[model samples]
Target: VTIIANLELKKQQLVLPKNALREAFRISHAIAEVTNVSSSARQPYVGVSAFAHKAGLHASAIKIDPSLYQHEDPASVGNDMRMLVSDMAGRASIELKSQELGVDLGGDKELIGRIVDRVKEMESRGFTFEAADASFELLVHEEVNGKRPSFFTIEHWLTTVERAEDQSILTKAEVTVTALGKKIICTGIGNGPVNAFDNALRTGLKQLYPELEVLELTDYKVRILEGRLGTGAITRVLVETTDGKGEWNTVGVHENVIAASAMALEDALTFGLLRQGRKPE
Candidate 1:
């Protein structure tokens, strides 16, 4: 049999018998098995799901034997196989997901029919659940609970702007928030609407959580839709922020660019506070 041995850097060469070729193949396979298991443990967040297929003929082949298409069984790489149903899906696929969710296929025909119809309708509207998995989870919870959230509420807001020469602008934003038998009003000033809004949000939240810090705005982007005269069009704003530990993104859309940026800014701050385990004031 082929023998395998670990040697120090100074003793790198190993003299072996010519008949040990078969043993070498076995040793190589054994080493490969161990390396595969070790590397899989270090796989990052995306992992195998980063490139799994779940549509068209590929899904069918995988369902038969994952080895047929997938480089490895999804489970081997710490990923569970998934199939996304859309307009292109057949009834079999729908039934599979329903059964997996523990829905009674025989008696729940009407509900299943409605779900498939709704999925098709929502997909047409650019509503995708693949990227925003948390949103999708919340949607499922709301559907099952039929319960409204009873959390903090925004009472009112006022924003004032002052224009200066050389394209410089100043903005002051004020917000009234009500939560947990308390009402707080805060105001802040900044170079732009989003900055002013974030400052106001932070001021309000800091009253409750004084240890909150290290949060900073990293980037902001705005896209104008329906370019009518290239001015007064629907604007979509994307905000990116980090809290020293991790970063997140949030988006808002509106006809007013400033309003869109303000909404996005509020979302970013709220998300950051949530991540820090503090409730918004």
Candidate 2:
């Protein structure tokens, strides 16, 4: 910073530890200016995927030395490396993630083939894994170990928005769950449709998953996708949730905003419970 003292030495003084970016972000969160950091995954320098490794050739090169593909070590910025498993995922990526997540893939060629094919199938249906690492982890654990993670299944649900004589809006939601063939219906009211659905869902899960009480929807974002020939267009919803312990995000793409929001919300809850090693009753 002492440019006047020595112009030639300005570069050395300007060089800063990568943690400086993280410190700035932390300060932003402290004043509530930035509601969520996970929302900025594409931000340069300190994003979750800033130093992420992909499958195939890229993953192979990174194994030899991350310096081949990355400009800097993720740790230099107080961030860790991420290896994403997706439809294009190769065996090398799976092996790397297995090592990181402690999952044993057992070196079976047929099993690895099946895993890759299944990921492709899900992706075809609009399921993405990049930002939802928790869901991906559970999927790998369940498929490789032949045991599914436990979570409640929705039987039926409905949402309604109405106006009273004074033109006040009323939003209501009702959800029913079929757990072990026992049905429980919960109805909740909120200021908006999404809020109403969330209220209903948490109210129903209260008796079963009390830990959900602490969970809150921290942020929500939606974008309209390009229209298809037969289909008009689709909506992509990204939902962030926090339980005081940590934060995670889930994404959903659908033709309807509400449906997309539902998908993200479901993934958020599933990831939250899985992280804590809990199985809903």
Candidate 3:
């Protein structure tokens, strides 16, 4: 039972221990894991998107007093409010999101303005940072540090698909990456182009950062924007990755679907490396 459900049950005079209410999200997620069922992101109190705020107007009110928008204190149910940064974000939204991600913009009005402009411009190009916090955080860090962390340089990546004589489809990918001042070439075979490319890149980098071996791609989603153009439309790819303990999302946009997937995959690995506390070479 969830805190929301229990609250409703309590209205019927059913009693639930305070400790049980405190463990609401944990219990719901634990059940999901044991049953191998995914919890809805929109589930009432425990969903990932349940407490996510996207509107700039709401963010302004939240900045003034979170209670202005929240029906109840999120912490009372083991959840925290999330301020999403998007094209519609204002200074207050950026400030709150930056603080949430532990980035110290120091309330620099000029820098926040630049970030707002960047978010708007990028969103216009089909990049949706709201769903990809890893990529968004990376963007924030790039703006704050004047550059992105360089974990490795990809010289080239290529994927090929072929139908075998047995009528089975095979995909192979080759990647050349420079890491730790060494250039390495690796190849991998998988069920799809993106999977093959992911394997090739990780196989090459596992030499320098063994911690990457634990990183796994959990979900992949693609959306075609400007669908009127059919195959020629811009493609946006969102990838979810986990390092056993936590998960994060990254996004990419390109005219070529494979290229878009490659961009998302790169960001996924880069963010995973960052999570491992490995300094860029």
Candidate 4:
């Protein structure tokens, strides 16, 4: 009976100070941090997936009326509704996602169709954007503007790992990029090729875009799309970045793990720089 009442209260939000419920999401995360116990992503009201809609049909209905699908307005609980795009998505899903990302489609059905086709083609190649909204937004920008916002252009990058006579593994990287119309070369050493590459890229750009100093890679994940292909399988890498105030994810796909990681890391920093309002050079 007690559990039932609690559930009812949560569902109805009948308490006098209903706005206080806005803290529920933050409080839940705080509890996780304090106890080091993470809640399920499917947890009602607070879960990451609670308000995520994936179906084209759902997106269609949501365009007409969001209340048609969601039990409650996500914002009421300090959460947001997300429209995910995949190969299974349709025009509606792309339209909704574009709007969510602040791109004005202007009801251009032809343009929408093009974006949808591109999304499907990319997903077929193993690039999934559901969890990497930053990458999705970049794609949308490219589609809308005819090109991606660029802060720098890579001329060349090289990473090598070596074992010293003492048996210590050392990874070194050198990156060359053009920013602000001048070529910059930087070198860095790290524990792995990806880490070394990340260090080299950031070091090269730090002088020009000092805002890069605050950006940090918080998490990384890699998946082999086809295990049967063994070492030749396409690799997908997801990189999560934080700017002290917020976090975002980006993704990349390639046959080379290092190349895949570099793609994701590039997107991550590009998104971060864009967020910082630094004009691309």
CA lDDT scores, all candidates in order? 0.55, 0.71, 0.87, 0.87
Q: For model 4, give the 10-residue run with minimal summed lDDT.
A: 1-10
**Better candidate number, 1 or 2, judged by TM-score:** 2
Scored by TM-score, the top model is 3
Clashes of each: 1, 0, 0, 0
Could you give candidate 3's per-residue lDDT for residues 1-281 as a string of tens digits? 55455554446444566445657777888899899999998887787777889878889899899988876666656777898888899988988999988888898999999899999999999999899989988888889889987798889989999998999999999999998889999999999998899999999989988999999999999999999999999999999999999899999999999899988988999999989998866
From the highest TM-score down, the ranking of the candidates is: 3, 4, 2, 1
Model 1 stretches astray by more than 4 angstroms:
1-151, 164-168, 211-214, 278-281
Q: Is candidate 1 or candidate 3 better by TM-score?
A: 3
Worst-scoring 10-residue span by lDDT in model 1? 1-10
Candidate 2, residue 48: how far the Cα is off, in Å: 2.2
Superior by TM-score: candidate 2 or candidate 4? 4
Q: Tens digits of per-residue lDDT for model 4 on 1-281?
A: 22332454556636536477676777777798799886676888877778889878889999999999987787766778888888888899999988888888888998899888998999999999898999999988888888998898888999999999999999999999998998999999998999999999999899999999999998899999999999999999999999988889999999999999989998999999999998765
Put down candidate 1 lDDT per residue, 1-281, tens digits, no spaces.
Answer: 11222121124444454333324333443565578742231232223243344454665565467678654344322345555555554444444544443433553555446555655665454344332222222233334445322234567777889877876778999978775667889898988666777788678867765544677887677776667748877787777687877655655667777767765565665556556676433
Q: For residue 140, give model 4's deviation from the true position in Å.
A: 0.7
Clashing pairs in 2: none
**After superposition, which runs of candidate 3 have C-alpha atoms over 4 Å from their true positions?**
2-14
Q: Arrange candidates, best lDDT first.
A: 3, 4, 2, 1
Of candidates 3 and 2, the better by TM-score = 3
TM-score for every candidate vs. truth? Answer: 0.54, 0.78, 0.95, 0.93
